[model samples]
Target: MLDGTLDGRAWRLNDRYRHHAASEVLRRAVGDPDLGRVALVSSFGAESVVLLHMVSVVAPGLPVLFIDTQMLFAETLDYQRAVTARLGLTDVRVIRAGADRIAARDPDGSLHRVDPDACCDLRKTVPLEQALAGFDAWITGRKRFQGGQRATLDFFEPEPPTRLRVNPLAHWRPQDVQDYMIENNLPRHPLIAKGYPSIGCAPCTSAVAPGEDPRAGRWRGRDKTECGIHFIGGRMSRRKVTA
Candidate 1:
């Protein structure tokens, strides 16, 4: 029963939920009858457990989408599996790039070296777009303190022509996330202790040093900040960029 212009509904929803607690925001989004089917698009990276844990408490059976990208660190894959089990999250769906697409577009797997953007499109963007086709809305873990393009994020945003994005942790500070994890006794991503404050695909992801922006390690030596998955009107938006 979700009806109305994308912007209209998105703005209205934002106004309604902007001041709600993170847990309440999530509960409303997942339980909204008008939202149709909503899925959580998670990378299972650093701090991802916060939202995953919240969803488990609100609705453990809710569909959780994880994009593998075929180039993730072994630790990330392991963390994904462990988080799901520890949180009792059901319906954890793994989305990946098709073999045919990989063979045709990146047979040698050097596309990441030549054109990281296209590589991201094939690996993350396209796969996520396909997986999200049937859902009216999706949840993300983006936060405002991540800096760059994420500094202005809101709890709800209209996804252009159609669809809506819900960011329950949009206003959470870095300490807030850490405290939530500690308070809930959530398991941390294995890479965090290894100086990898921000984690992504293996080749494009590097470890950051102390006193560095958490995202400084990702796409290092390149100007790219995002993987092209979070986008608006053909331009990429923000993903995880916090420490």
Candidate 2:
């Protein structure tokens, strides 16, 4: 279980590594006793390969928790497998919502149509929360360039009651992501060529038009911006940690 000290530790880590490069942040984090047990939470989406590749290089055997909502695109599932094999990631854990929970909450799979937030909680957030219970911190692929609540993301953040969140690529830009993938010869998500810059569950995600936000396709025509995995209540838990 986590205590109040976790927040202080996160703040200190942020201050220590604020000016470090993304690779340095990750290298120090992988085995640093301060972080305890750390895991990488990946969506294996459009830009996931960059961080995934980084992890492969830095710590190939690190625990990688992947939430398979059971509603993802076929291409996403295939890409997950291909990427794992190509990167030689030995400890990729596939997380999913319990069958009983799905039966109780979304029997007909229409929950996304009527209540996307609840659906996201059932499929993504809850499963990830449960999976992350054993770790002191988890790493994410979120970048400040994504805008919205993530625009002010830091390298390390306190995740409320317990746990710390790490965003090694918090300062990376869209071009940085693209350039990294191209320079490293990483495999791109197949759906990207089809106008799906940002991929999520098939039912809620659509294709973005030119000059539109990359995430515009997600929950199109709906007021939902996030899947409830990152936010607490329509906002990130970004309370400043003071000395």
Candidate 3:
């Protein structure tokens, strides 16, 4: 059971520990106005098919936001197109960093090397915040096993002050992801077979060494990890949630 505290208070998951039942969460969220405005953000990365497929099954027309960092691999672009069509996902929108922001803040494109946090704010966070302006909550594919800041993920918790974040696969193992893919005959990201177990922007990701953390390849050799696209709160400060 998820009995841990969140922000010095108990976290609730719709009155139960929602370690399974993606369909239940999907249906419930979709049936309510505040929650139904929710959208699924996908990277079309190594293991995104699980959640993407789940969302498709529950609501094929539900909006799915895909952040095209413009620095991603060609394979990922193709994969995104192919997967959406195959799953009959009717509402997949491609979002990107505002071109003006990129030109003004990161003209040379090496901002990530010198200041990853700021780069992420401009490239990933700001646009995502704008894209999600009207949402009450959002669904994430995060799992506890990713083992960083996610060790205590719950089924339903406050993203902060405004949104009720939902994570249906919080307790799933890597094997669970595999089982879902195999059971459903889902298409795999081509880069996964090329040793990029986790995918992100091309410049930040590389093939990992044997036994390295699955996310190690991302932002390799840098003091950074997440691109901050799915950050819990404010685009610039990470201090407030806008839902």
Candidate 4:
């Protein structure tokens, strides 16, 4: 449990670390006794290398949670392993949707065609919630420039179930991510050069052209922008809740 209430602690810490750089923000969050335990949630996508590199520098052994929705692109899986090895991340944990759950709800593996929101709930959101149960705080790679609900992204925010979200790169821009990856010699996700600015599951993700939103390819032709992870509050009720 946190020192005080979870929301209370989150508010205070968000204020304290708002002005700090990503490295310092990460260090303080991991070492913060009040938060109990912390973990990093990575999609291992296009801009993920920047934040993962930072975590490797500050706390290599810190738990890194990767949600393998089982519907991800083959290259994403390969890239996950490659990046983990390249960055020397010590505690990379792969969390997945239960086999039984998938068999029951999506035996055909085509649920995303009918209701993408339900697919995300069963494959990503619920599994991640289970993985995060042991952690007091979790970190994400979301940035303000990502647009949509992420336009107001902050360094820290209090999420539901009393957990704090630490967005170390909340203020980082696209150029910042590109420069960090180049300077650090990080391996780029293979699909990036193939026009995929934002990578997600194979079926729901596509390639974007120049001048398109980095996330424009995700859930394309649909009204969905997120896969039910970063959404908070009443937004949860708006989706098909299979959890």
TM agreement with the true structure for every prediction: 0.94, 0.94, 0.88, 0.94
Output the worst ten-in-a-row residue range by lDDT, candidate 2: 234-243
Going through the candidates in the order shown, the clash numbers are: 0, 0, 0, 0
The collision pairs in model 4 are: none
User: For model 4, how does the per-residue alpha-carbon lDDT over 1-243 read when each residue is reduced to its tens digit?
Assistant: 445776777778887887798889888888987667899999999988888998888999999999999989999999999999988999999999889999999999999999999999889988888888788889999989888788888777877666788888888888888888889999999999999999999999999999998889999999898888888764543232344
Say what the RMSD of model 2 is. Answer: 4.6
Which whole-number lDDT from 0 to 100 does residue 24 have in model 3? 74
The best candidate by TM-score is 1
lDDT of 2 by residue, 1-243 (tens): 434486788878888899899989998998877788999999999999999999999999999999999999999999999999999999999999999999999999999999898898888887888888788889999989999989999999878777788999999988899889999999999999999999999999999999999999999999888887787445432232221
Q: Give lDDT tens digits, candidate 1, residues 131-230.
A: 8888899999999999877899888888755788999999999999999999999998989999998899999999898899999999999988988766
Query: TM-score of model 3 relative to the true fold?
Result: 0.88
What is the TM-score of candidate 4? 0.94
Q: Which stretches of candidate 1 lie over 4 Å from their true place?
A: 1-3, 234-243
**CA lDDT for candidate 1:** 0.88
The alpha-carbon lDDT assigned to residue 106 of candidate 1 equals 100
Best by lDDT: 2
